[model samples]
Target: MGPKVIAFFLPRPPNYPMPFVDVGDDILLDILALCDVYTVIAVSAIDKRLHALTQTKQLWLSLIQDSTFRHVLELRPPNNLELQLHSTRELVDLIKRAVIGPPPWWPGGPSSSRTPSYTIAFNTGLEIIHDYRLLPGARYMALRGASAVGKDLVMYEVWTGRCVWGIAKRTLTRFAIDVVPGGTTARVLLALPTAYVGGGYHLYVEEVDFITGTSSEVFRLGFATRLKSLIAIVGEFLLYSLPSSDAEEKQVLVNWRKSTYVVLNYGTETNSSAILIPGYIVASHPDTSPPYQQLFTVTELDAFAPHWQPLTTISLSGQLFPSTIPITTQERLEYKGRPLGEFMRTHVRLSITPSAVYRGASTVMVYVNEFPKPRPTPTLTAQMGAFFRGRRQPEESARAALLTYWLKPPGQACGLRLVSAQLATPSFNTSPLTPPRAVLEHSGSSFTVSYYQ
Candidate 1:
């Protein structure tokens, strides 16, 4: 007898619309795989069957592999492919959160008034004379100050407020401090300014051993014979703003690890700041015939004008130190001259001027301080004497606001996104009101930590 063949087709009712639920899981997954993360999330919420199919590990892993995806999931990827499947839901949740802003309890939201996970009061005898720097994970804080005798550097656990290590008062004065981000090891860079004329600053790099409660100086270098202010440390480069001479402003980059330096002159004197973006230090040359020649980005800020200028890339293989490239146009924000106080009165605003800026892997965070204009209060005027009457006094409290932006391409304006705005009460004992310092965390969140009288 001849071999018999059987054919099976999915059942369909006449004059009835095709039921999406009847679709096969494999077919559904294939379709969902082509959708972007946001689309996938939206479709998954439509029905239980589609949601289950979208939750498969294969779908999320494929989405992550797509080069077009800009957002990232905060969770770690598993080593085992099967185990990775289990993280599909977590990856989806993180992606959703990133697309939407932070949760209410996160630092950027209004509900952040909830007490911090940890708090520490300054010791009875220790007074913080200088600002402090927090490590990447917020696990440790590095504080530098001048005591009764001399300057000291102290490292403390953020949660427990225990002193992990201390470099007591020494003859050397600490100019500035920076903490390098790492997991197991803690490294700090201390700048010691020179007091002698024509003498440059000293750079001290130290590694702290928490177990032994001791710190060892690993590297030291005399940065220059000429006095310069250490502005910032980005990656392995130390940025120094040169003293203005003959009304000309300039900057220099010292790669202390590699023992090389570069001088960049702005031609005209303008208040400026510079920051180096890690990993992007090297890039392909645009005009090279080989199409693979490398270059580096040098981002400089025109502080007076409040604009960012990304100068042309310098050849990494070039011999000229601090190679000067063609001057690029400026990327200016619209809220340049607008005062933040205008927005603080309502306790809410869409966009405001940024007083300080910090860059992350793919975003830029800006800080704003707004002191509210005072208004006459009926009760206070009647209670006080005639000397205090008839005068409108400014509010003693100010608002500390943080705004975030997605780092746009060169020559593009950064779109501002409001994050957190909080009211801060000034300390009566302090002569001048000091704005709270904002710190950005690796987990895409930020917080303002301040000390009052």
Candidate 2:
């Protein structure tokens, strides 16, 4: 309704800073990107225009692309998280917290040694759960039921407990998930047993795309119908174990992408536990007296031939075994007022599980739990007494320790270096009668342990 107002605009006040708001969004974003994360955050709070510019997803993504806080990202990976779900302030806060390191109450921090900082309950909707894996980045978890029918794999977001993807109608004999870089996709290798035309069952290596839920058969091999096996995938390489004809375990390494595999000679250790990383396969036989771990590297024999061989072996004698375990004696009295004593014998038994590996940092974490071997089946009265006590009896000792070993970097040594060791008094109060299963999550710098009944 008013006449042309181009000549009627208000005059600029003295010292009024207008240039800051006059820049194009592209130029402003480029300048903000050049600044450190904190500086950008500080600039965002200066004015509305600057704040809007900093809020762009492109700006935050650019910063994440150049961030060097890899270990921090591993602890809270961006898996299943969409940028639109978070605001600029939340994104900036994440980077700031990562730069400052995890807080004391963080599950991976020192406080976890005493008690868990927090807990999350995941209901599988099944009565029996066979096994579950907390996927890398701690964003999602995969679970398999103990039943052989109905359902196979169920994956859900860790925070919201939302079912993102699932597979039904097939039994997942053994499976491993490798979340590829950028958190855009995950690769799952499934070992499915199928009945052949004649009689015997053959296992198929089926690869599933975590994002789309599409599956394709990678390879097929004959496996002993009665024998148990384990499989792990890292990138394109797959490490699996099978029982040899001599009853010894055969460790096989396969690059499923190239469709080539080589059988590794692990030298007749039937009690070994093997785990796969990006470029290495670590196998440990903790049942032995002292316990030892072997590291095998995937090496290429030629352009067309790739094989894995023994790289180094590390002795875990003094580390995994505890030195001073408390010894206690139990005394039982005779009937009436007479004094009669009974002796109870106990010895420490050590067991270790290879928990996680920081691929780029060359670090590995192991969970060790040492407890006294139980005596013969106790009388009903004694069992009830133990139950009423609400904790482990004085005669029994339980200790849980975390051991970290740093693998030798390239072109240096051939042995693993002991980085840091943490020992804690384990409390199994959650499931006193039944031993609680421990779930360990490591973030390169620190690790967290969760117990499941």
Query: TM-score of each candidate?
Result: 0.46, 0.47
The C-alpha lDDT values of all candidates are: 0.45, 0.48
* Model 2 stretches astray by more than 4 angstroms: 1-128, 146-151, 159-162, 194-201, 205-207, 222-227, 244-248, 268-271, 285-359, 366-403, 408-453
Query: What are the per-residue Cα lDDT tens digits for candidate 1 across 187-248?
Result: 56666556665565567667677657777876667443343566555555556566676544
Q: What's model 2's TM-score? A: 0.47
User: Candidate 1 at residue 396, lDDT?
Assistant: 68
Candidate 2, pairs of clashing residues:
none
Give the Å shift of residue 156 in candidate 2: 2.9
Error of 2 at 366 (Å): 5.5
RMSD for each of the candidates: 14.9, 17.4
- Report the CA-based lDDT of candidate 2 relative to the real structure: 0.48
Name the lDDT value of residue 280 in candidate 2: 50
Candidate 2, residue 202: CA error in Å? 3.7
Q: Please give the distance, in angstroms, between residue 400's alpha carbon in candidate 2 and its true position after superposition.
A: 11
lDDT of 2 by residue, 1-453 (tens): 888656677889998877755778899889877665656768879989888787887787667544233322444433325644666667666556544433433433443333332233433235366667677655566777622224567665554545556676354567777766445366676666555532333445555565565667665553423225656777777676655666345566666666555555433444334566654555433221212222212222232142323322211221111111110111111113322111121111222222221224345554434445466787889889889988655565544544456654233334355566565344421212212233445332222444221
| Per-structure clash totals for the candidates | 1, 0
